[model samples]
Target: MPNPWDLPDELPTDLPVSRCELPDGRVLSAVQEAEAHTLWEEISSAAPYRKAAEGLRPGEAVIDVGAHIGLASLLFGGLAPESRVLAFEPAPKAYTCLEDNLARLLPGATAFRQALGAASGTSELTYRPYVASASTLYDDAEDDARNLEAHLDNIGADERTREVVRRTFNVSQRVTVEVTTLASVMAEHDVDRVGLLKIDVERGELDVLDGIDPACWPRIRRVLLEVHDIDGRLGRVVSRLSGLGFHATVSQWGVYVGGSVHLVLAERD
Candidate 1:
């Protein structure tokens, strides 16, 4: 396979490219250098999905919703090398980087350039070029800004860093993208069992969960998602998962203390 991630001959020239060298000496590509570092630290160093991914069986699939630039998928592939990876990313730039990264780093992994939601159709996605990871289908500018500010305060980020982040979220472009449901994807791919379903779709986490068919719930062994607990969404998600026979646990990291963001780890009971 070609190693474009190492040499970058096939990458787009118009968009800025950022590469981070993992502790394992593997180079990953992204649109922003700082974001790339942060993703690597969270996905590889911190390893939030480690526990959920541990249950992966050989030939099972690991589904990554909101995969961004494929950092989390890369981690999953490392944690469960025998399993397959399927990543979904809606934003054009981010999806491009994700497709490239997975193609070069994870040869057989599949990348989809569509958003997963409650129903399959076309939707307007808010794409933040500066902060590509923050792009989402739910475009609540005020709430997003406030949440980011709180998160930055909780992390004690410097004023310069705060200003830069604020600016990144301030400007965004709306793009029409194809949307599909998780159940549809599973059926299409003939994925009989999902070892781990990792979701990080900004504030649209609930919608992604709602998209999963009731029949498919039994196929998902574990789910790890970042939920923005706004309007009692956290409670609803927990209840829904629990009803579906999952034991869910919620925790907050220091970086998200002042904000409503949290991590929910769910395993089949």
Candidate 2:
């Protein structure tokens, strides 16, 4: 299947592909990068159906952590439209682009421009907007860019760029949106059943999962995650989930930051 993400040239040879709504289905395609928007399609979370399918079924509660320019949400919406999707994004500039993309593709989707961490209070997702390729919130942008070092340097990555600290990726766009554990979110929303829960929170995955309770673990049937470039976070996640009684695995898929993300599955018990 074609990647649902609209790539740099996904717009085709047609010059300046602005917004166009098809007559029959009303698929409004908008081109953001063409107008020098400076955003890149994160292969990490954009497409890859298996990543989205892992531990996923109908009417599931799928949480998208660090959902930048939401292609995963679009996939979940398509796969499980009836499911409740909490798409979290934390970059102001990128979140703006995310809104534009979601409005055009997933109007029914709920957008949370905040970061989801283990402790849940707050943490910085150190980044270099100049290195848009490595903007996955909590992960080290430098390391994630190692693979794209050459290509990105030609386009972006400037040593002279200014640096700043932020609690949310979108500090200016902060909304103090309710922060809750995956368990808390489900209970509040009256989620009797959770089909799939996906997290791509950079290095924050370790902390996020660690924050959950043993009871909450079993409630989730499947878990797809983009593990950080840490020593044992990936293994810890699989072990923890498996211990809670669900089959899990690290899947093979191209990602912008970090290596291939892990696709851990935990079947309902």
Candidate 3:
């Protein structure tokens, strides 16, 4: 059998291409090589987000927060062709790539070049070009460096391993991004209910969740979020979601090492 991760021979060279075709046979576009690799990992996962998206119904609404390059949005559109998807990505380069991918694969979905935060305003996003997904509103550069050093010391990590981590987390650029609340955006779009809500913002997961009006919480049927627990917000986020009357589960599956990140999936009881 052919290697599933191999780049397709027939892939269009004129545009940035997805490393692999999605489950529904739609291709994604990647602005960088790192983004393409990440997309392939998600496509190959057996239990991504604990299958939270499995609950989405046709013609329902889906929100893809931190929709870097629009892979998830494309996947959702393919899975639920009738569903209206709103994809939010703030990074300019990634947003441009997202726009291209969505237009090419799922023309009906809306892609927004804005970040979701606790309120409507603007904020700085610390971007790491080496690892685009590591870009975040929380500037954890010092903390990350210190933590990595400590871990290396504990394990007596080789020079190669230490160097890899250092380069992977290096900052490349800082950009100001427009921010809005989930509740506000939904209202502006006249979207009253959502069948699936997926959040993968590096460390702004809670801020995005907090931005959703409490009254509108009931209208969200399911949530899959990547929570950066290294900052110690996991407990608070889980508690907040539980208080909203949802059955919540947190796991390290599908996340990077260090036990600092986790996937939180919640659905109404």
Candidate 4:
């Protein structure tokens, strides 16, 4: 079967604002050309994540950690409209797009313009233009770029090689952003139980998971994370979830020089 994510190739041109309805009826608004591909991938190849949100009951909650521009949040809302969605994203520019998209796509949902980390405080984020999705809280922007280049070189796929050279090889900037913990946010919102907790905080997956209070572990029914083991956190994450009685299912998505990418789905026994 042809991957749905393989859409028609389009020239990268800065669009002030572009709006499109996802196959599921949720709206995605991209503020820059850099965000276009991210939106496409989210809408097109989102079967697994969508499956994770299924079986949700009305009034249940879904938490989107590192919800860059609200892709997963919107997806969750569309998949389970009766369920509430709360999204957390720290990048200012992306937050704006997130807020706008959520308000139009799922008005009942919430958006938090703060990064979720191991503690509630503030941290600096390396903002990369033309590739905002690669922004990370772990400060591995340069290392990530180098690894991506190395992988593209080794893959030897002409189309992917050209895409990488055109996209990931871009400019970056740094800025400080507010940070908070999942436990704290849950308490602030008076949330009792979470049906699904999806995390994609670049290389800071473990930090985000660490912020969850141990006491609240049972409150979370499922956890889906895009894990980057740059600091050797993959094993720790799997072990932690396993200790919490979550049967972990891991899918190795891609490989790079310094580290590999994985998607981990952990559900309570």
Candidate 5:
């Protein structure tokens, strides 16, 4: 399986390699290397994602609800070679690139070109994507005006601009998509034991969580998400899960502003 002709025969003593002269007529580098495919090596170590990568083991089922180009999935795959992952990315361009990258990086990983939410039926989805925040779910009304509290709840805003934007502008959409809830889809596949679940569905987080039942929260071991502020508080999201006994702690490592990326790690007692 190894081609000896491409390596040096002498292999230096001070170097970090051992050379083995083949019986027939070849030299092996004796340097072992593990193949990898990652966009940036350092980013994979930046978040709680780094800890997730370390805890990963072969065959653990993980779900990437908003897999953008499979960056996290690929990194998880590299850390746990034999694990099976399910990736869902809604944006057309991102999903396409996600599949393409997975094909070359994590060939065994499964990819879904659908958005995840609390419902199964088709609902309008605005593609904000990861790179842009303004490209969020558009209001049907071009001149739709939302109060600052409403905007902060849907998007994120402090007391600073609550009434300002409501008095000023509008939002529009160039596209819309159908979304499915995780429970419905996973139920169809009979996945009861979700080892890890990461939700970064831009602004559709509330919709996604709405689909999950309080009873099922115990089954979900981890939920790394970008939660939106419904009003001026994270209570609505927190209260819902808290009633179910999930110790929801909010943190400030961001991919989404106004609200923090909520890493609500829960375990069944």
Candidate 6:
């Protein structure tokens, strides 16, 4: 396992990074203004992951898969100061922002510029610079656009706001990135127990779960992920967790009622 600290010296100079100041006075770096604001609203203000973060003890570990720009990571760090935060992000620009944010805000945290999947290898990731949070290895532009439109309508976003979001998904680029399994990461870092495993990899939630070797399942105390109920994925994920001795609960925010997105929280039985 490579040390995340030894990041490449030459970051893309042309990448446009925007800095957002939260109401609480903390600043965050992001590529897109709208995406950053939305993330802050959900991860910080709304605090959807709050329930799963409860009981996080000192010195425990929180693994954030698809950590777009470290907003959630910052939340976890603030919730449990001594706890270690291991954030995994595959997008190049996003990873750079994530690294910088963690360095300034959560010095003890570690940011990995790699994706966790069912295997260890390299793969092409569809990265939307304008909507960085939606980037994923499993790209579904049409479905994503539909879901976004529905969500905006459900929340009663104005026409201008809807147009802004529509433009964000219009352009994207594919970048090849390193991919590894969660079991491999745990073994390399010697993580004996995970306080929480928070995953929001667009539609790649199940693949992330599959990356965990059977032996590592019991080590994860809690699992929180955004599940796109494509096909029978939601049910399959619930069954898989149940089989691993976890009690899984599924719920959807009112804004996502008509969309395929749902949140699943699984705790060990």
Clashes of each: 0, 9, 0, 0, 2, 0
Model 2 spans > 4 angstroms off? 1-48, 54-58, 130-133, 136-142, 145-180, 254-269
Higher-scoring candidate on TM-score, 4 or 5? 4
C-alpha RMSD of each candidate structure in angstroms: 6.8, 9.5, 7.2, 6.3, 16.1, 7.9
1 versus 5: better lDDT goes to: 1
Residue pairs that clash (backbone atoms under 3 angstroms), model 5: 148-162, 153-230
- Give the C-alpha miss distance for residue 265 in model 4, angstroms: 0.5
- The RMSD (Cα, Å) of candidate 5 is 16.1
Cand. 3 Cα-lDDT: 0.76
Q: Of the pair 3 and 6, which is ahead by lDDT?
A: 6
Residue 177 alpha-carbon offset, candidate 4, angstroms: 0.5
lDDT string, candidate 2, 139-209, tens digits: 45454445444333444545432111111122221223334466556666676666666776656677667
C-alpha lDDT values of all predictions: 0.85, 0.54, 0.76, 0.77, 0.55, 0.86
TM for candidate 4 is: 0.83
Candidate 6 structure quality by residue, lDDT tens digits, 144-252: 8668888999989987667655665656788999999999999999898899999999998988988898889878999999999988999999999999999998988
Highest-lDDT candidate: 6
Order of quality (TM-score): 1, 6, 4, 3, 2, 5
* Candidate 4 structure lDDT: 0.77
Worst 10 residues of 6 by lDDT: 3-12
lDDT score for residue 165 of model 1: 63
lDDT of 5 at 71: 65
Q: Write the per-residue lDDT of candidate 1 for residues 1-269, one digit (tens) a residue.
A: 75422433333324577677777787777888778887678666555577877858998999999999998998889888999999999999899889999998998999999999999999998887767898889977666866888888878889777765666556677899999999999999999999999999998898898899889988999999999888899999899889889999998777777777889999887
Q: Show where candidate 5 strays beyond 4 Å.
A: 1-43, 128-135, 138-173, 254-269
Q: What TM-score, to 2 decimals, does candidate 3 have?
A: 0.82
229, model 6: CA deviation in Å? 0.4
TM agreement with the true structure for every prediction: 0.91, 0.64, 0.82, 0.83, 0.62, 0.91
